[model samples]
Structures are given as structure tokens and as C-alpha cells.
Target: MSASPGQNLFRQPRAVFAVAFACVVSFMGIGLVDPILPALATNLNATPSQVSLLFTSYLLVTAVAMLFTGWIASRIGAKATLITGLAFIVVFAALAGLSGSIDGIVGFRAGWGLGNAMFIATSLAVIVASATGGFAGAIVLYEAALGLGIAAGPLIGGLLGDISWRGPFFGVAVLMAIALLATVVLVEPLPKPAVPTPLSAPIKALRHRSLLTMGVTALLYNWGFFTMLGYAPYPMELDATQLGFVFFAWGLLLAFFSITGAPWLQRKFGTAPSLYGALSLFAVLILIIGLFTGNRWTVIVCVIASGVVAGINNTLTTQAVMLVSPVERPVASAAYGFVRFIGGGLAPYAAGKMVDHWNMHVPFVVGAVAVLIGVAVLTTGHRPLAAADAAMAAGDRHTDPDEVAGEVADEFGGAPDAIDFEKELDHR
Candidate 1:
């Protein structure tokens, strides 16, 4: 039997905790700038479009670099990748903090994205390889880390950003430095892949229909996701601290739903229906925000409420991609990351430009329509998704155990039988 989520969360090896801790600080980078967007614009004498490039540069570079992570890991090994990524984040985050110009900070943030892609791409494999519970437990732990980091990032940023816009950047550098040290001391080195992954693997994975479908769906969904994440703060017009609290609430819901609520939802509605329902609701919410951009309370409520759907989508979409794809898990993940991050990276900058050229309401309107189109795109793969769901229901599923094993080869390098593939399959 699978362990409960609570048990999975706490009953883990020291190495798991070390990587999970680092995962939390790594995810914090996602929302660290939420409360500071306004301050960044004012202090740097930049327009919202220029300030929005922070997200664009960071995520864009991260997206492009994801294609190479598996290749790098296969050659150098996971521990080296993790440490290298962490080192880059510590240096780049500090450089961003110390930057005198918005353009300079933007450049540094791009560097931070490179490090982030390497860390995030490898962290899951390490968690899966090292965690005590089965693969299910490791996934829950990873998602929990994601939730906590995302939720806390804005709060931390708010508290520090209230002092200075640069405070959050420096704070991340300090925290990441600590995480880097913990990783070095606690986690053992992992084995490199017997055959190094090709640079073209992730791109090749995209040729499969189901993988391509989900990737496109994710891309469209991200258009809505980042539009809200990047632009909604401006419409609400809250100060740094106030914006922090608001997004903290949003992230809290997101974290809670991702860890607990998503499974319940999947159990009740199944994956595809749940996704469609959530996407529909998300579209309605974005439309509502666009309709009522002038109303602060309404916009705030919508922003927070959107997290529920976002959380559900995050968990389900990831599962769907894993279940439906035929490629190795690492390649599938890298491919999905490549496509979705491009959309995520671009949306914020587009929203900022839209606001500059069009109006405040236009971005949300575009976001809503894009989300609906994502729902439509998902329909093309319904038959395959249904097959995946049926396979999952029968307790007979398959994932890339070799890839996961490669991720933490040092811990289980000589003990291939240590991983229970059947239990891991069921858990997903």
C-alpha cells in the first residue's frame, strides 16, 4: 500500500530533506518579485514593460536551457548539476540585487534562470531516487516543497521589499547560499547515465502526438497563468506589503490544493474532466477580472481564487503528461518544460506591453480567450488521455525507471532492485 501524504512528507532520508529544502528556496524565485514589481518600476524609472522583462528574461532563458539539462546531467552527474545550478543562482541573484539599472538586473535574472533550469530539472529525479516512501511519496514531497516555496516567496519578498526592492534579491542569494552548502554536505554524488542523453532527446520527444498535445495545452494555459501572475498586481494597485499578503493568500491556496486537493479532485472527477472543469472556471475567473479591473476588491478576490484552479492544473497537467507520454520521464519533463516555459516567459512581457499600448483589461481578456483555446486543444488528445486514465485505474502503468535510477545512481547505483517500480507506477 502507498503511504499517506502526511507520512510521505515527514518520513524521508537526510538527503531528501536537503534537496527538498533547496527545492523550496529555488521555487521562491518564481514569486519573489511579485510585491516588488511596482517598486522596481518606480525606483528604476522604467515602464511596466521593462520591469516585466525580469520575468521574460528569467523564464525565457530557463525554457531554452531545459533542452540541455538532461544532456549535462547524463555527462557530469546529478549532484554536480545541482551544485553548479545552486552556485549560479547564488551569484546571479546577488548580482541582480547589486545592479544599478533595470537592464542590468534583467541581464542577471537571465543568468539566474539558467541556474534555475538546471536545479529544477534535476531536483525531481534526485527526490525520486533518494526519498524513503515510494515514487508517489517523493512526488508529493516535491509538490509540497513547490507549494511552500511559491507561497512563502511573496511573503518573504514583501517583508524584504518593504525595506528595499533589492532586499528580496539579496535575501534569495543568502538563502540559496545556505541551501547550496546543505546540498554539498548532505547529498551524496549520483552516477552519470551509462549512455549520455542526446541534446536532441527532448526535442525529439515533442514529436509524439500526446506529448505535443499536452505541451501545447500547457503553453496556452500558461498564457493565462502568467498574465495573472505578472499583470494582476498592477490592476490591484496595492503597496508592497499589501500585495505580499494578497499573493501569500493566493500561494497558500495553491500549495494546499496542489498537495491535498488535487488528488481528491482526480479521484472524484478523473484527470481529464477535472482539468476541463478547472480550465473552464479559470477562463471565467480571468474574464471576471477583466470585466472588473477597476474594482480592487473584486480583482483581489479573483486573483486569490484563481490559485485553486492553478493548483489543480499544475498537479493534473503534470500527471497527464507523464501518463500519456511514451518517452523517458526526464525527456518528457524537459520537453514539457521547454514548451510551457516559453509561453510562461512570454505572457508577462506581452501583458505589460498590452497594458502600455491597449488598456488594463485587454490582457486579461486575451488570457481568458487563450485559456478557452487551451481547453479546445486538449480535446484533440482525448482518446489517448482516456487510455492513460484507464491504465492508471487498472494499477498497471509504466514510467521511465531507468531515467529515475540514473537521477540518483549513487544511492542505488548497485541496487537496481531497491526501487519498487510497481508501487511507483501506482502512486503516480
Candidate 2:
């Protein structure tokens, strides 16, 4: 019999734990710099727009690098990709800490993004392949690590930023190095893809209706997500520690909802209704923040509240993309990552520029509208998402094809069974 989800969580292998630990640290990089943005501006003698480019550079590189992740992984294999990505992050994060100027830090961050793309794209596939209790269990574990990382990032940033603006960067370097060591030691190497994925694969994957639909929706959703994440710190005008605590609260709600709340909601309301309600609620929250940008208490409350919906959206949207797409999981992830990261990368810089020129309120107002646009985009994918939901309900989710093929090859001590391969690929 299949293991229960609760039991599956504990039954994971050492390799799973190693990679999951790395996932937690990798995700922390997303929010690790939040507590230090204001500090960076002060110490580096930069404007908000300049500091915001830190995100722009990092995400832009990550977005572009995602296109090649599938190609590289298919050639070099998963373990090499994971280690290379981690090494890049460790080196660049430390370099970012050592930089003397904002421009220097931004340059290093871009390098960090390239590594991030490789790691993020491959890590999901790894977890999906390695975890037990089926796809749902793996997703829960992945989302949980994401939550913990996101939640801890700002707290770590806050504590360290109290020492210096550079402290958080160095902290990520140290922690990620440890994660890299764990991954190298614990995670067993996997066989290379039997058929190499072309470099054009991720780009081609976007032609699929379900992948494109979810990718575009995530693009729109990210505009709102990053607008709040990138700019909210400025309006609050709190010190590093206070800003850390506030976002820590936000990240906690994000973590809780992602791991526990999202699955519950998906089972109860189904994917479509759950996403619609959550995105709508999130758009409204953004509107409130826009309307009350000048009110510190109101901004803080709205920012924290946004986490609940954001958390739900994060988990549900990821699950939706994986389920609905017909492409290999890694390719789907890369294609989806390419679109959303572009939006995520662009939004913060845009928000910063908007704040620089127009007003703080304008960015949030625009963000609210963008999120509502995501709601509309999601509507276009109703058919595919419905089918995916039905598959989940029927316990018919597809396993990772590369993993299935590897297992078949091991069992037969030669080429995989073509029938078995086709069955796994077409399972959904």
C-alpha cells in the first residue's frame, strides 16, 4: 500500500533530506536580502531604484539561464547540475558580501542567479523522483522547504544586518556552502537522461496550452508578489530588525499556508476555485496596501495578510503547472520558471522606478491590477486544470519519466522497457 502523506514525509531517504536542506537554503536567498535593502541604500550611497537592481540583475540572469537548465542537466546529469549551481551560489554570494559598491554587488548577484536557475529547475525534479507517497507527498515536502526558507531568510538577514549590510550575503554563502557539502555527500548520483533534451526544449514547451497558460498567469501574479516584497520595506521605514520581524511574520504565514493550508484548500475547494478565491483576495489586499501606503500600521497588516494568499497561490500554482503540462517535469519547470522569473525580476525594478518617479502608491495600484489580470489568465486554463484536478482525485498523477526509465533500466540490466516508459509518460 502507498504511504500516507504524514508518514511519507518522514520516510524520505537521506538523499532527499540532503537536497531538501539545500532547497531550504536556496529559497532563503529570495528573502535573505529584504532586511538589508534599506541598509544597502544607506551604506552604498544608492537610490531605491539602484538597490532594486540587485533583484533585477539576479532574477534576470536566473530567468534567462532557466532556458538552458534542461539542456545542461540532460547532458551533465542531476548531481553535477546541483553541485555546479551550489558552487556558483557559494562563490558569488560571498563575492556579493565582499563588494564595495552597489554595482559590484549587483554584478555578483547576477552570477548568483545563473546558479539559482540550475538548482531550482533541477531540485524539483530530484524531489519528485526521490520522494515516496507519490507526487502529492513530494510536492508537500518541496513546498515545506520553500516555506521554511522564505520564513527564515528575513530573520537571518535581520539578525546579521544589525552587524553590517554585508552580513546577510556572507551568511547565505556560509549556509549554502554547508548545504552544498550535505548534498555532495548524501545525494546519490542519478543516470543521465536516455534521450538528451535539446536546448530549445523549454522554449518549445511553452507552445503547449496548459504550460503557457500557467506560465502567463504566474507572470502576472509575480508582478504583484514582487512589488510588495521589493518595495514594502521602504514605506515601513522600520529599522532592519523590525523590518525582519514583520516580514518574518509574513513568511511564517506563507510557510504555514503553503505546507498545510494549500493541500487542505485544494481538497476542499479544488484547484480552480481555490486559486480564483486566493488570487482575488490577494489582489484586494494589494489594493488596500496601495490605498494606505502612507499608513505604517495599515501597510504592515496588509503585507502580512498577503502572505496567506501568496502561500496558497505558490503551492497550488506549482502543483498545477506540474500536473497540467505534458512535457517532462524538468522542462516544464524550466519553461514555467523562465516566464515567472522574468515577471518577478522586472516587477521590483519597475516598482522602484515608479516609486522614484511617481509615488509609492502607484506601484501597488499597478500590482493590484496585474494580479487581477492573472485571475483572468487563469480562467483560460480551466479545461486543463480541471483535467489535472480529476487526475489527482483519481490518484493518477504521472511519475517523473526520467526516474521511471532509470528504475526500469536497473531492473532489466539494460535498456528500459519501451512499453513501461510509454505507460509512465502517458499515465496522466
Query: Which candidate achieves the best TM-score against the true structure?
Result: 2
Clashing pairs in 1: none
> Could you tell me the TM-score of candidate 2?
0.92
Please identify model 2 stretches exceeding 4 Å from their true place.
Answer: 1-6, 396-428
Model 1, 9-54: lDDT tens per residue? Answer: 5778888999999999999999999999999999999998898899
Evaluate model 2: give its lDDT: 0.86
In the order shown, what is each candidate's alpha-carbon RMSD?
Answer: 6.1, 5.4
Q: Least lDDT summed over 10 consecutive residues: which range in candidate 2?
A: 412-421
TM-scores of all candidate predictions against the true structure: 0.91, 0.92
Alpha carbon lDDT of residue 1, candidate 2? 13
lDDT of 2 by residue, 1-428 (tens): 12363574658898898898999999888888888899999998999889889888999899999999999998999999999999999999999999999999999999999999999999999998888777777888898899889889999999999999989999999999999999999988887767787888788778766678889999999899888888889889998998899889999999889988888888888888899999999999999999999999999999999889989999999888876665678988999999999999999999988987999899999999999999999998786666566655554334543443233233323222222334435442
- The local lDDT score (0 to 100) that residue 294 gets in candidate 1 is 94
| CA lDDT scores, all candidates in order | 0.83, 0.86
